[model samples]
Target: MARVSQAHLDARRRQILDGARRCFTRNGFHATSMQDVFKETGLSSGAVYRYFRGKNELIRAVAEEAFDRMRLAFESAGREAPLRPLDEVIDGVLTRALEEQARRAGTDRPGAFAELILQVWSETLRDESLAATLHALYDRMRVMWVVVVRTYQDAGHLRADVPADHVVRVLMALIQGFIVQRAVFKDVGGELSSGLRALLSPEADPHYRG
Candidate 1:
């Protein structure tokens, strides 16, 4: 038997993941069959097993991919953004996530990290491992929020005595609350965004401008 190179193996794995995600999004987790992934990939069941042992394993892989992608999104945002104040950093990230989610709100993008997140939360009773992956991702995102908090603290925008880790927890909770509310309602107060901006803005804005 000819040995597959690492690059070749990685490419084939990516291909299988892509097809599996499409099927999951189209048919939903419960509805999508292993055969659906096989059909999507045009690979036999045995060949698919070579990449992923089962559908659950595939879901875990997809979850890992989703987290890695989101992390990349934040890293890209950090590089491209103008370094002005801390609030801009937070808004930049939240805006990206919100926009991406809004795009997938109604669709059957089961492969979407956001959709997978909801499914994992709803189905955790039956899928512990998937739920663990999601919990880990959420915890990692909190670290990003903590960095923003420390940035503001360093800029003298927030009280120096305030704890960065504590602030991150508060911010994460705030964002999560908004997401839950937005799911049920059409409009959340724009004032919330304006308030966040004000919180990060220099209090002596008028005097500093002069």
Candidate 2:
């Protein structure tokens, strides 16, 4: 009998996710079929169905996987000793995210998670559950940033006149807007850190003590 241990089970789950990600990247969420994933994974119909009840379940898992990656990316950036000030740190983090996202670009079949994330963002508007899930992820990310911003406020480093919470909100909004804008229009091009600061505050430079 084939031994099904925890490692094996996890491997199967990752296999399905990897396969779905590739197929989703190639065909998009709306067009991809479960049969496509099965073909990609080399899993039997029954075997694939045993792990995922349906496509929705598979997509949700894929989304969770994507979110996990983004969360780690941001959190790790926050922990790194920044070479610049608070605002610069925020800018730099986004700079990295944009760089990574841009690297993820290329209509030439990037990966399933790329289009998957975009589709989820678009579909969240029509699907209440998906919207709620996306909102929760956003909230968590914002909260993490709030802590980072608060550090500057406490140090009397950030602008005293402006609410730290507002700065946090601005940072998050800039990240989201830049990602969406870049995805939709490939025109805005430059170093993301510099671009983000300029986009967030056209008149102000992040290097200046505020």
| TM-score, predicted candidate 1 vs. hidden true structure | 0.72
Q: Give the alpha carbon lDDT tens digit for every residue of 1-210 in model 1.
A: 998899998888877988876676556788988988998889899989997889889878876675566666765564533365545555566566655643433343212444454554566678888778778887887776566666656666666566888877776666656555544453553644776777556563555431
Predicted candidate 2 versus true structure: per-residue lDDT over 1-210, tens digit per residue = 977899989888878877887776667788989889889899998988989998888877777667766876777776643334654665555556545543443234222233456787887777787777778887888888777666655555555456667887877776666656555665544555666555444236556464
**C-alpha lDDT of residue 157 in model 2:** 53
lDDT of each candidate versus the true structure = 0.66, 0.67
Give Cα distance to truth, residue 110, candidate 1, Å: 12
Clashes of each: 1, 1
lDDT of 2: 0.67
